[model samples]
Target: MMTGDAELSMFPADSRLFEDSFSAENTYRVSGQNITIHQYYCANLGVSASVWESALHLCQFFESLDLSGKRIIELGAGTGLVGIVAARLGAHVTITDLPLALAQIERNVACNTPLSGWPSGAPAVCPLSWGRDLHRFSSAWEFVLGADIVYTPETFPLLVDTLVHLCKDGAVVLLASPMRREHGAQDFYSRVLPEVFEVELVQRHPESNINIYKATLR
Candidate 1:
């Protein structure tokens, strides 16, 4: 848990952060497999179109776990990197985000075909807006993942509601995000999340200012 007030740097919430003026595709090597992601920088899409450092850290953390045959669903799956990695590691993954973000995620999933020869099938891409259409999804997932999804305080309640809905069947939730103090990321982890679930800081990559949290229903 984070303590006392400290002069923290602000996490730029500007949409310009998503702009990659260089290449439309970024390649990442995860779990010994190379996953290429296609990203869009439409200002209307906000941060949902780009892959953040938290997603990369989550992928690194996933490398340490045996995700084979696990039923996983990822929320706010920007660019689908974490879910794609989980699928590559043999987990049955469903990667979801807002409706507009699905196209890029679908494209990435298609780009990484035959994920690790699992033969189970490719990841399913869907649209999920927090706190809405909760019944459209099942609560039987074995694992729920979110990377960099806590930066917006306005969505904190909805995100928590969605997590609670998804974890009703005892599914474990893994959330990874940079502690962006300016955006209340710390508060979401330290205060908001703990209010509903038993939260534990499983890993902290201090060099990258990212923390991976494991949570389950209280």
Candidate 2:
């Protein structure tokens, strides 16, 4: 029941109820920007709004910077919202997610296709699984973006390795997530990334209920 320029659908189990509950589709309205993103189904292995909000703030921060010509890649792009916004803001952005989630991300990209104006090029949607190879998207990007991707101690090392592998030296790495569960990811970044990355807390959103962080290659 999403009625707009976007003919988006919902997951079967959650679709009917969600459609009936809200008169309009839910969207993230980025501050200081005219762009907005609409999400339909959150996929099976979904990320929360706190993550999305944090990513939006980080993206806004990126937009505020001088990135007229820079290569960017977004990891764990559940619905491609952050990547799309980055592309619109003139970064050569590549969107990656689990293969299973690629279709929905592509759909969301297509949904906002007209609005996303990357003069350099359109953002490429690629498959990238953590702890796996990332050669297809190339090994160079000025910045690597991730939102709500860090979770579970088991995946921490691999995520770090992946980031280090794909990002070039001096590349800025941006990550946003809500501190969830008892996972040691916060500690891992605090302890480990300093060896390779200059980590900094950019924004803590109590209103949006998320924490957005920025890290740069050291």
> Of the candidates shown, which would achieve the greatest TM-score relative to the real structure?
1
Q: Which stretches of candidate 2 lie above 4 Å from their native place?
A: 1-25, 31-45, 48-51, 115-117, 207-209
Computed on alpha carbons, the lDDT of every model, listed in order, comes to 0.83, 0.66
lDDT of 2 by residue, 36-112 (tens): 44444433333421235657677667645766668888987877777877776677888987665677667666666
Candidate 1: tens digits of C-alpha lDDT, residues 118-165: 455689999887777688999989999999988878678878999999
Measured with C-alpha atoms, the lDDT of residue 22 in candidate 1 is 40
TM-score of 2: 0.77
Give the local distance difference test score of model 1. Answer: 0.83
- TM-scores for all candidates: the values are 0.88, 0.77
Best by lDDT: 1
